[model samples]
Target chain A: MSGRPLRTFAVLGFATTHTALAAEQLLRDLGVPVTPIPAPASIGNGLCGIALRLEPGDVERADTLLERAELRVAARGDIEDV
Target chain B: MPASSSPRPVAYLDHGATSWPKPEQVVHAVTRALTDLGGNPGRGAYAMALAASRAIFESRRTCAELLGVPDSSDLIFQPSCTAGCNLMLKGTLKPGDRVVVGSMEHNAVARPLEHLARTGIEVVVVQGDRTGLVDPDDVEREVRAAPTRAVVCQHASNLTGTIQLIGDLADIAHEHGALMLVDGAQGAGHVDVDIGVLGVDAYATSGHKGMLGPQGVGLLYLSPDLDVRTQVEGGTGGGGSESPDMPIERPDRYEAGTANTPGIVGLGAGAAFLIAEGARQHRRETELVYQLIEGISQIEGFRVLGPPAGAPRVPIVSAVHERLEADRIAFALDRTYGIAARAGLHCAPWAHRTIGTVDCGAVRLGVGWGNTSEHIGLALRALREIVTS
Candidate 1:
């Protein structure tokens, strides 16, 4: 198997784009690497088109930080590369 | 009306109504938001959209810092403090519920409560002392007498500049199972106010007043513990489209329709300026307020309102002339002295009643972030001449 990085990543969706941006700022402040991506259509409950994508390994860490910040996490999914 | 004596620069002491000559940073931010950051925030996933969203997010963060709000999402941008008051008062209280308020409330609070009263909500007006100070014990007595849904009071009186004991009132309200709401229109940027310390359930303030921002924008800070219902409903940009109801999440739940990007940007710049230079500005303004009070009090027929010289108050001073009417003084101040001031009931008829000036009203000079000793001196000299002539 080639040593290419996996395409699958953990995505966190929110009820509004503000929350998604808020989450992005919070995780970045906490030293967690995250990217704001268009929420895949697969995440059905996502109201905001934007979502935060992080390494699958960082899902639990990101969830803990976002929850602590009181940002509502609307949905979570393991999505392929955009 | 002939233009009179020394044509000194206009003092512009009407900051109580709204601050004039906003800081340079605020002007720049507003221009940038309108020209460069023109995208509708949260409308789409384009670069411009994200840039606009980021700018607004930064603005929210700055305002949250100034207000001591832990979660930036809890603060909502309002068109005016009046709108904020309506949302908090109407959203929380229902028919048959009772609310207590101080008599010094601006019409922003009084009018909404009046509207709510027409719908069966009971509004109790607690009279303050002669100095416009509200006693916490009086609030406690009212809440103890009956189950009150909320206790509303101003952080600082717009007419008299008397600062209220908000933390004590908040404690009393919580103990009595009532929400504590503050109209900080004159308090937030004029004096130090930390929502975390004040413990108010909700604080509504205008951005243009003490905040030193432009008009058409205000702030409403909601506590995490309170569950206020939505007041306005519309598109909140790319969220909860499937659901007809407003999204349950905050920052968007209460904020409906397109965001006021330019106004929010200006307000943020104003808040940031406060964070940098507010303490020094407050000290200078307070000194000027005392000077105005002392100088005006020395005039033969004028009686300065609000707290005594040594007492703590915001940068506002009002005085009623024994011989002249309020509007006449204000008119002379503007035309002759080139000093801007406010007269009449000050949009606070109840405040005028409390001070026994409802009939004649009082001339008010509101110190702002940029007032200096010379401005106060000019005003005092102008008042002396007006009273004597």
Candidate 2:
């Protein structure tokens, strides 16, 4: 954990800040427990540079929740630890 | 007991400007913002700032849902409908670009486009018919004739309350490779707005109008594909604060500096209330509008303007007098009968000219959800007495 990247954490990007915030809210409401944070520059495109962070192993579950809610995710991938 | 008799209740019929007596939730939400949420939104790392940010986002989400926007971030806050218009018109139109706008457009859209026109943008004014309705075919003909960059029109005529065929107009604009911009000031909060179905490039409305939000707040919905150049630039407080350029992100790219957090929160609550109440408010307002139209039509010297009876429209009605001045009748209705109504050109001189009321601007009575049959009756009685006496 010294200088490596955020491994195991899934950064879910969205087309806009509000949609990402909505995703975070819906995920938490569904017990997925996510936070809205700034996706790193190296990460894929996201609206307003905002992203939803999910627990290391909760990526798939979070995707299911978002899909069930009809929320679109721009990009979802594990943090590339440097 | 005096049977709870009090002074006569003023019949407020100026809602076409800004609705009054907002839903209770709006009042509570604003109060909560002033009390519970206190901090610079997106400016600090403190819990209070985070809470403030949450309120702002929540408000945006509510507006997005109400407008049926596909992505919430594409919509941002503006000080008023006028400001939103400036952003859309100025941000999109360039020198020598031709833009087409409806004859019934209010100053909010007309003024900005006019300024652009002076600065080398050509603004083509499409005339409306007698009913103040802009024909989509006319717009199509204009677009097909000119090298137009965008077609702008009001969803509903504030002067005559005639709702235009926006989806039809938008389709026409799209067919000619023109972006469609809709000034939704008289629409939105009054009727159901589905931006996706309407297929507009940009739609703007004042929150204080049909939405029942407070003043100093407006909403703009833009499709994700259109890149509207930002008009205002400053600290977004999101990221890239050090960079001189505004962020490429969605709302932060548009929202500069601080915002009216409390007012916007109130707007969100108001929208949420309307959404929950469903279409009951709309149905009530429609019925009252028809009643007002019929009752006013029966008045001997009065001529109710707009689409005739049985034609679909908003709750707004404008009537010009044959023997009396419009302002004089409006003043009598207000001073004598305690009915609040708007008179004059209603910031739409062109619309008056289209409806043949430019010589003597008409009096407008805009009913809203808060009005009832008793209020309408009082207004009708006042009109009858004013014309006869």
Candidate 3:
């Protein structure tokens, strides 16, 4: 985790009317360390301000969990270390 | 048309409007013109001017090939689709004549007709089905209802990506002794358009959109049989007497003032690129659109607009969720993810009214040659997140 920068992946799909609430709910349900990340310019993953960041090592687990919850993963990328 | 060799992973899905990231060869051609042949095309008699003239001539020839017209001189270059439409509409129609337009026409066609409608000319609008399909029979009926001077319609609905049957409509218009004008804003480069085969009276198109060239360039194709009045009068570089009257010629009469030489030259390169890449590949691109429609339709709350699946359509899809506002959804997708899409009326109020999506307007996703299956899938996933959330 120290060597690898924190990676970001956009859970693609409609953030319908309840996107923020749903995002909060999903984060809580997964109980995995996650945070809201600003939409990345390099990856045009979403049109809104709701992207998710996770520790690089936990991305795979996050993807599986989101998929099981019937969410489409829009884009996956490594968070560039500034 | 500037050259950039380094490849990036950006998925360009807007070719129905204009091709993005034009081919390297088009860029090279544009570069060559800017560096070498920078003189005014038809004004001067110098070598550089001749070279510029050759570039313009070559562009006209390439446009001829694209539209399947035999004579390159029959085509005239204007600034944009609107200018081409103005030239054709203003040049041809008199005050007392009747003009019939389709409901799904872009403003380029609609505005001119609306302006003319203020005059004594009668403007009749032929409505399309809810799916954006215009019936040739309806067009025929409209033309027959009155003495129609010209029947103007778009070859494809830019908002919905619905391809109109221009040939059938042309025959219908011709039967009623009316000329047909096609706004090929969305159809020219994305689909196969054979002016010879269609036998349309006039075809107006933008160079920037679909043709994959820079803006301020458009092409107008006139049939040999139709005699159009000149919209404006000016020099055309042929040593005609400096008369205040318009030139008594086909293209020279129509094309007035200095032409967009660089834009037209780039358009030629763009057309050449289309020909070399095989323009038929657009059908394959539309298949991706079908896939998107199919995938999105399976989602419970999502509703896709435009022509039905498997219908003869271009690679454009408009859809929205039952619970989400189209603009909100579009904003969410753009802000939360990086999906670049267009939403709202898409500049065709008549089309939106016809489709009953005028209130919210549909979220439009246009796929181009540059888009891939992966991009579609990614878009679908993003849509699902926005909808289900």
Top of the candidates by DockQ: 1
Each prediction's TM-score against the native? 0.93, 0.87, 0.78
Comparing 1 and 3 by lDDT, which wins?
1
DockQ of 3: 0.01
Record all residue pairs in model 2 with backbone atoms less than 3 Å apart, i.e. clashing: A5-A81, A48-B249, A48-B250
> Candidate 2: misplaced stretches above 4 Å?
A1-20, A30-82, B1-9
- Sort the predicted structures by lDDT, highest score first: 1, 2, 3
lDDT of 2: 0.85
What is every candidate's C-alpha DockQ against the true complex, given to 2 decimals?
0.46, 0.17, 0.01
Estimate, for each residue in B169-273, the C-alpha lDDT of model 1 and write its tens digit: 999999999999999998999888889999999999999998988899999999987888898998886556778888877888888888888999999999999
Runs with alpha carbons beyond 4 Å of true place in candidate 1: A1-10, A30-32, A54-61, A64-70, A78-82, B1-9
Q: Which candidate tops TM-score? A: 1
In CAPRI terms, model 1 is classed as: acceptable
Worst 10 residues of 1 chain B by lDDT: B1-10
Better of 1 and 3 by TM-score: 1
